[model samples]
Target chain A: MAKSTITFEDINVTVTVPAGTRVIEVSEKVGSGITYGCREGDCGTCIMKVTSGWNHLTEPSVLEDKILRENMAGKHNRLACQAQVLGGEISVHPV
Target chain B: MNKLELHDSDGKPKAVMLSERVHWVGSLDPDLRTFDIILKSANGTTYNAYVIRGSEGVAVVDTVKEGFADDFFSRLESVADYSEIKVIVLNHLEPDHTGALPELMKRAPQAQLYISQKAQSMLKALLKQDEMSYTPVLTGDRVSLGDRTLEFLHTPYLHWPDTQCTYLAEENILFSGDVFGCHYCDNRLFNDHVGDFRFSFEYYYAHIMRPFKDYVMRALDLIEPLPVTMIAPTHGPILRDRPDRYVRRYRQLSSPSLASEISCDQKTLLIFYISSYGNTRRMAEAVYAGAMQVPDVRVSLYDLEGGEVDPFVDLIEEADGLIFGTPTINGDAVKPIWDLLSSLTVINIKTKLGGVFGSYGWTGEGVPLVEDRLRGLKMRVPIPGLRVKLIPTDEEIQACHDFGLELAKELMGLRSQKVLNFADLA
Candidate 1:
């Protein structure tokens, strides 16, 4: 597994993540700054805004997109577990 | 929230907003703690009212609660200066929405109360009037205002047949009487304004609207293509936040997946029995009370004498849990307990969980008999059957609520087997 660097805009914290790690997983490794429930993505609690580095994230699941378009998802948001980190720099605004 | 800020679905500001002819001077029912068999978070329900500011003449849509006629009149006063109105549209003949009709008509002597054609005879029968200010407009009927128009879609059995929804094309707002309503009474109206929005919508959908599945589906299909930006129903907050989210939920409830979707966690049904002079009934209730504390499992209480075991049998046959209780008899089980156990054995119905309860004068008879019966039925008894000689102490009752929490986990392992609404099985 390869490690990648991740950053949060609100907390000004940086963390190293292994390859194939999801943004949601990276979110958990950092701390309780993020809120998520039903990790299955049914509940719309874990959405966040994508401030930058969206290209490094996996495509949003169908349910994720639906929540985002409804203005229910947080800023530039993507489901953390659903969106795997792809060995690149990423920036996110916690919602 | 600004009224003009409310936009049509096509991203246009509401160029035409209906006049405030009708006002919701309705009261909330404090006693209505649980409405339509579901617990309500909102303390009470409000009556929705609208006034039509027509180019020809003003029409008040509906009135509020019984005691709140003055407020409705005040709202109507703000909409139009005319003391005499032209038409008063009665979308639904239900009392809360129509309670103020007589007084409203008296105030507006020139106004005719409009109702559906199907509802025409029903209202006349209810009101017992031959020439009361009534106008019967059913389907394909149009009420035109110089600036705007109201088209009636007679929604049959969507709660009520007289229940018709009006569409304002120029403003693109659906004066949907009650079809898309919540029980909210907050001043902060609209979807986005209400935090924790999904629960209210689900409560309305699951309890109030779920029963009328077919009519709801037909109604949804009819409006799916319409350019609806805002939905003002007869109850709850106005859907100005994000109308699409509520609309999508309605669609999901109506979709075919409703039959197959297992929304609850995997759990077995828990049936508890309770009785008073019927001591066994107490045991049944205690067992049920116990199982309910458990999460993820469904609990049902059967009274050997009080409850009919036949109707709830499907819940029993498919459930992974079971409980029985009865009062003591001449050192023997009560007749109903014997009958129920015999019925279970005859049917060969079995489950993964089981328990028993009973009261006795000299000694307990029901609990032991119940255990023997369940064993004969080949039903699985995971926990030792509970026996109470006389009445249960406070600890005994605590045991019941606690029992529920434990079985909830056990039942969680059982899958929800379909008894109805399955195509292949059907």
Candidate 2:
């Protein structure tokens, strides 16, 4: 399985995991930041700004997109629980 | 059966029977310290799923949180097989109630999902399954299952937009999703047998249901006529004894008593103002003096320059009328005034009287902009906005006073005549 690198820019921490790992799982494993509520995309608590390598993440699901739009998030923002890594380096920051 | 026998003789938790055909197939999380990262659940909580067995098939109303899937499935299997589930009712699309849905749908692939009409897109998004088939239900929609019937009441925004209530006709039970639910978890399945949960009940309503009080009232109106003997909500103890008391409490909490208080001949008028250079402050004082001339109208003035808008929200919601005074900076109203206007979204101010008075240099657009926002919120702007140049002259100050007086008179007339239009009564 291919590996993906995730950089939490705000905390200056980086982690490596399998390509298909959800960003929420990485945050939980790190346990430093990014508070969560509902884990599903219904709540916008886990919204993160994709600072770099945005194409390395999966497309936002309908729920994630709706919630992100509701929160007035920009195109670079994605829900940590809804977007999975696609085998590349992705840098993000919690909004 | 006695309440103490919630567990088997071996002391393991078992499914409790609500009626001959309705079983409480839910999971209890007694160690849960918090919910949704906001509410503190010291008494823990329960994900109350119910199983209804008809002569022909079975239906499941709601499911537990994702972590409790094993317990939920064990309890569910104790009453009915996974293949027997013909219907799955999603009372609310929030994850606490629908977290186990993916696994449940996989096991009970034959079950058809039913939700409120507003919940279609939400269901698709939450389940991440756009192709999932579901029956959209309205207020009076009903689905028959042999000898029993499941009726849906479209009660949206009890806390979420996808919320609805399911009533079981044969058992006289209301599967109220989160309406009368609490976060207190206990082994006692029924409210009659549980300890005092008054704090938990009120805490749940204050934290979850308070923001949508108008919807709570609307939801109450929809369920008022039902002969509901039991209220099985998606959380906490089942209200099997005098469930109407909970409904009455909701009604009392949601109903604003300010209107009735005005009927006793005392009405409140709030004047909020933010003045940059004492020009708008003079105009606000004139407006306050003018409003003070009206009989039985209590006027309170607040300067918004350095004050927070939150403390005045309840007062603003209860006031009979409101006047906003602002000093135009550049081409718009001051930020404090805009902040005050934005805070109105959380409260119900639909038909209240509103007026705007401001002092601006050249544009004088601040007063009209504030008036437009008040009108956009569905408030009644009986009089046009009052605007004066940089500082008000004596005559303009009197005009500001008269603006306040006329608006107060309009409010009094509306209250007295009970008419939507002031001109109609005049």
For residues B315-394, write the lDDT of model 2, one tens digit per residue: 88778788999988889988888888887765677667788999999898898888768755656665668999987899
Local distance difference test, per candidate?
0.62, 0.84
For each candidate, the DockQ is 0.01, 0.01
TM-score per model over all chains: 0.48, 0.65
- Kindly provide the TM-score of model 2 when superposed on the true structure, using C-alpha atoms: 0.65
Q: Name the lDDT value of residue A91 in candidate 1.
A: 73
- Least well predicted 10-residue stretch by lDDT in candidate 2 chain A: A27-36
**Which whole-number lDDT from 0 to 100 does residue B110 have in model 1?**
83
TM-score of chain B of each: 0.57, 0.76
Model 2: reference contacts kept, as a fraction: 0.00
